[model samples]
Target: KRILYIMIALCLTSFVANYSMSSGAIASEKKDGEKVKKTTAKDPICGMEVQKDKSTKVEHNGKNYYFCSERCEETFKKEPSKYERKTKKGNEISDLSKE
Candidate 1:
């Protein structure tokens, strides 16, 4: 009887440990994917709205540039003069630049 009880306790402990480990991994993955969808901005160069995961970002001239596509980023890089206008305040700019 004591041996049976010990085996049952071990089985229960292993099951609990496995359950917690899998759940923790699933929760973290959900969090990671969720972080990308929270907020989005419009790409000034291409005039398209971009989500966090979907946007290509570049840091230049003490600012972060968000682009709707890689083509837009290339365009901005090739002729930065065309897109030098700053529309947001410094604090707002900083907030959008965060990862």
Candidate 2:
């Protein structure tokens, strides 16, 4: 009967919609609890490694600097030139290259 066919079609459509929605919700839940590794950068003032995401960040001269602690951050803030990168010149070597 036409009514029987319509009922079957509606049931199938409802089942498919529910299946898709539940699958999408499970996918989103997995993504919500995903763990990501954080990258590390050296504290310029103390030379200690610190996680980029967890450390205090400061920007100087268009560059970002990460610090292990507020003390180191303050030290760099006071004299950033002391921790600024040095470039190697002709017949010369950069100190950073040695590390």
Candidate 3:
């Protein structure tokens, strides 16, 4: 039926559009060609996803940490160790900026 064919075409178009958008979001990288996926990070101060390039950022202790707001940034600046990312394994993500 023509209606069935139209629905199929629409579905395919939607699939293609979504695929491209998802792929494009992950196509970003750092200056050293390290691929950083546009995924969620727990904002040090608020536990929100700090999206790639879309979230507000502050460079601290030689690594770039993302924040949900200026208030969170100020909070982290005052006591960075308290706000630093900690792994579930009881380790901290190394901030190599000091090197």
Candidate 4:
């Protein structure tokens, strides 16, 4: 009877530990998914905040681009020089252009 109780206790302890580990993994995955929640940026051409996934994007040179609309993306692609010129001025242009 003592041996049976010990075996049962060990089994229960093992089950509890496994359950805790699986729960922790699920919680971690939830946190990671939260981090992936929609990332947004302003369209350089139109000055509109756009969700990176929902909006059209163009990657030129080393930068990730976001667009308010397909129209803005097309305009940006057609005349990247125009946008590149403004970007060189950094946040100064971004701040001024926003207003």
Candidate 5:
């Protein structure tokens, strides 16, 4: 039937559009040919996954950390060692409700 054909065409179009969007989001290249992906880091203060480019950055002990908000960043700044220890032990701070 025509309706069935139309539905199939709609599904295919949706599939193609979604595929393009997701692939583009996951990876891209810089002008210098460096591959860039949507890299995410767990916020040491709030346990949120933050995009590195968008989040607040802090460097301590030669490592970089990201935060979801200014409050989280301030918290980490006050006691970098505490979070650094947690990170080293693979303890991710979950439970955003605490914030």
Candidate 6:
């Protein structure tokens, strides 16, 4: 009778552990294939909207700059002052070379 009780307890413990682990795996797997949209900000280098959390960001002159891609980030790193204008509303990025 004592051995029967011990067997039942072990079986219940194994079942509980398996259920918890399987549920956790399913929850994580659901997000593994999903792409979440991040909070939006302006890409200073291109004057386009960017996802601040997802996009690459560079900090210069005590300010943060977001970029759409690594290329834009490299361009800004090369010349910080070139794209220092405000990028909001009707403000457009003027090619510094043209001006």
Better of 4 and 5 by lDDT: 5
Candidate 4 residues lying further than 4 Å off, grouped into runs, are: 1-38, 85-99
Question: lDDT tens digits, residues 1-99, model 1?
Answer: 975455445434544444444423322244635732334454556444455444578776676677755556676788865566644663332323433
Of candidates 6 and 1, the better by TM-score: 6
Lowest-sum lDDT 10-residue window in model 5:
90-99
True lDDT of residue 24, candidate 1: 31
lDDT of candidates 1 onward, in order: 0.52, 0.56, 0.55, 0.53, 0.58, 0.55
lDDT of each residue in 1-99, candidate 5, tens digit only: 975455445434544444444434443356467765536566766455555555678877667887666667777789887775433456754322221
The whole-model C-alpha lDDT of candidate 4 against the native structure comes to 0.53
Please state the error at residue 36 of candidate 3 in Å. 7.9
TM-score of each: 0.45, 0.51, 0.48, 0.47, 0.51, 0.46
Best by lDDT: 5
Evaluated against the true structure, the overall lDDT of model 2 is 0.56
With candidate 2 superimposed using the best TM-score fit, by how many Å does residue 34's alpha carbon deviate from the native? Answer: 20
Clash-forming residue pairs, model 2: none
Count of clashing pairs, candidate 5: 0
Residue clash pairs of candidate 4:
none
Put down candidate 4 lDDT per residue, 1-99, tens digits, no spaces: 975455445434544544444423322243634743334555666555444445566777656677655556677799875785454756533321221
Candidate 2 lDDT over residue span 1-99, tens digit each: 975455445434543544444423222233447843325566676565445555678877667787655666677899887787666554532322121
Pitting candidate 1 against candidate 4, the one with the higher lDDT is 4
Residue 47 of model 6, lDDT score? 54
Identify the superior model by TM-score, candidate 1 or candidate 4.
Answer: 4
| Residue 41 C-alpha lDDT in model 3 | 44
- The better-scoring model by lDDT among 2 and 5 is 5
